[model samples]
Target: MEEWVIGPRLYNCYKCGNMICRHDDIVSKTFQEDRRLITGLHTVADVYCCDCGERLGWRYIKAYEEMYKYKEGKIVLEKFKLANENNW
Candidate 1:
């Protein structure tokens, strides 16, 4: 599996302060990305905070399984503790 990113360089849903560890979470949509080096083996999922309905980010799900590793249907994001620190 790919190295799970965390720490200083991570994402936090500013709209709702939803961390990826929350019990209730899910990816609500699929968005586009710069897939130049990618082999189209993944589907981008739009993650959100279940409590506040805030967008987290796009998830790269394996094409074969079509499932999420974070929650039941959410991606396990290494969200930054604070807001918009190194998010650029």
Candidate 2:
């Protein structure tokens, strides 16, 4: 299993002012092929606040000449917790 470092960078809810941990939150990644005759793989990361549960922004991972958008959502922490508890 691959592990990613959960940065200490704090994210606060705009409405509730609650601190959120990225490691314990949900993150979605989307990927698609460019419609144009481009040559590259494109991907986007949709980061959510997890506190107020609002979408933060769409971070482009793979850069390409044309733009291709696809949405993929997952509750990473919840899945991890469930896996740890042997739910799966």
In terms of lDDT, which candidate is strongest? 1
lDDT of 2: 0.42
- Superposed by TM-score, candidate 1 places the C-alpha of residue 9 at a distance from the truth, in angstroms, of 11
TM-score of 2: 0.31
TM-scores of all predicted structures: 0.34, 0.31
Estimate, for each residue in 37-62, the C-alpha lDDT of model 2 and write its tens digit. 24456455656656566664445555
Q: What is the C-alpha lDDT of each candidate?
A: 0.46, 0.42
Per-candidate clashes, comma-separated: 1, 0
